[model samples]
Target: MQHDEFIIQVSNRAPLSSRDHAELATRATLETLAEPLAGGEPFNASAQLPRGIAEYLRHQYAESGERFSLDEFFGRISQREGVELPDAVHHARVVIEVLSEAISSGEINDICSQLPSGLEPLFEASSQGQIRVNT
Candidate 1:
């Protein structure tokens, strides 16, 4: 699939629009860090990429009732991608920290805060759709 299409697939699966963006950003960052994770790489001993994310979020909601620690969130993702997750995890954490500080300092809601609205929704829709139908 093309990059845009891949992003769309990612969106559909995300539980919330914001979470989808974070997830996609993390994936893109990971892909850029090394090589894009090979398709169909076994994420862990059993789970695939989508499954890992779903499990992570499910645990998050079950435990904290809110997302915490981009490091933890994306760390699980990197593992699922079958890569050493720390580089991506650190990068993602930096981005989050910067964004959090910016939001505290200013009024940026979106992480990038410049992209078109509904873009994240599209991603969540596309990603979740693909996972349920294809995977």
Candidate 2:
């Protein structure tokens, strides 16, 4: 999907009001999701993401190259967003759902391939009937 369309979809799916809010949410979610990957994998996987969202993941990879577990991923997002864990998970699901529609199956598969087995469910949950990753 195009950048504008991606933002509109995110805004509609999320509780955000404007494109800027949608952009912020997208960036935050992408960064949180990418935080678990090592080396340049995050940037490579983010290549198929929306432009603004991809930049955020690339920036995180360049700046810190931090790695964490799936639990820590949601924890950090919850803390940063000042929401509870369930809320953070819901936000993640929404973003991943949008991403599943925006990017190609190959791209999604590539991203999931880099993630550990435990993390795959997080993305797959959003995909629902569309993408199913065997655990």
Candidate 3:
């Protein structure tokens, strides 16, 4: 995702930020995942996540030295069965999940390659779930 596309995907879901911060956040999260592709390991499990979707999360982690946090927004929504998330996070999760699936399928470069073309459609299709970005 030539960095810019990753930033765009994040801004599509969250508040926009300066380009530098966006890039830093993207690199941080990707770096967190770039090693030892053993999926079942703890770091691997946590690293598989996409934390760069929200500028706030990135800024928070950068300034406060905390990694991505689900507790702040969703508060463990994925843990409790039948509990629903707020529309925004839900939609963001959809986008992230799709990206994750593509990554897992060894299509990271393929998906990233079609970034400009594929991104909007992926975001739009993810909107079909019970979620809305409101922006």
Candidate 4:
């Protein structure tokens, strides 16, 4: 998907009001995902993502090599967004679900393969359609 399509899909799946808001949320989520997959073959996993999403992941390629678990990932997002943990989790789920739609299934599968087992629930949740957004 293109940047505009990505933003629209994310906005539709999330509570955010505009494309700018979706862009911010999407970038934050992709950056957080990069933290775990950095400095390895997995680091290049984002290459198969949509152009816009890939850009977000690429921006974090040179990050300080921070690593985090799924829980910590949500915590960092919460802190950065200044929202409660639950809200952050919800936002991350929405972003991930939208990403699943925006990218090829093989890419999503490759990403999941690179992550720890603990993070499986996030992808499973998205696949189960647990967070559908009203059109």
TM-score of each: 0.25, 0.76, 0.31, 0.76
Regions of candidate 1 where Cα sits further than 4 Å from its true position: 1-23, 26-74, 79-83, 105-135
The residue-level lDDT of candidate 3 at 20 comes to: 56
**Local error of candidate 3 at residue 90 (angstroms):** 12
Off by over 4 Å in 2: 62-67, 125-135
Candidate 1, residues 54-99: lDDT per residue as tens digits? 2332221232223334344455556654446754454344333322
The CA lDDT at 124 in model 4 is: 61
**Per-structure clash totals for the candidates:** 14, 0, 0, 0
Instruction: Please give the TM-score that candidate 2 achieves against the real structure.
Output: 0.76
Residue by residue across 31-133, what tens digits does model 2's lDDT show? 7767656657667766776676677677634425355667777777777666788767666667777887877777777677767657777656434466432
lDDT of 2 at 74: 74
**How many angstroms is residue 86 displaced in model 2 relative to the true structure, after the best TM-score fit?**
2.5
Q: Which tens-of-lDDT digit does each residue in 1-135 have in candidate 3?
A: 333565666555444355554443344333322221222232322344444433322332222222333333233323221234553344345344434542343344333332333132222223444322221
For model 2, name the residue pairs that clash: none
Top candidate on lDDT is: 2
lDDT score at residue 21, model 1, on the 0-100 scale: 67
Could you give me the TM-score of model 3 versus the true structure? 0.31
On TM-score, who's better, 3 or 4? 4
Per-residue CA lDDT of model 4 for 8-79, tens digit only, reads 877887787778777877887777776655345334656656676777777645344455577888887777
Task: List candidate 4 stretches off by more than 4 Å.
Answer: 38-44, 61-67, 125-135
Candidate 2, position 125, lDDT:
40
**All-Cα superposition RMSD per candidate:** 16.1, 3.4, 12.0, 4.2
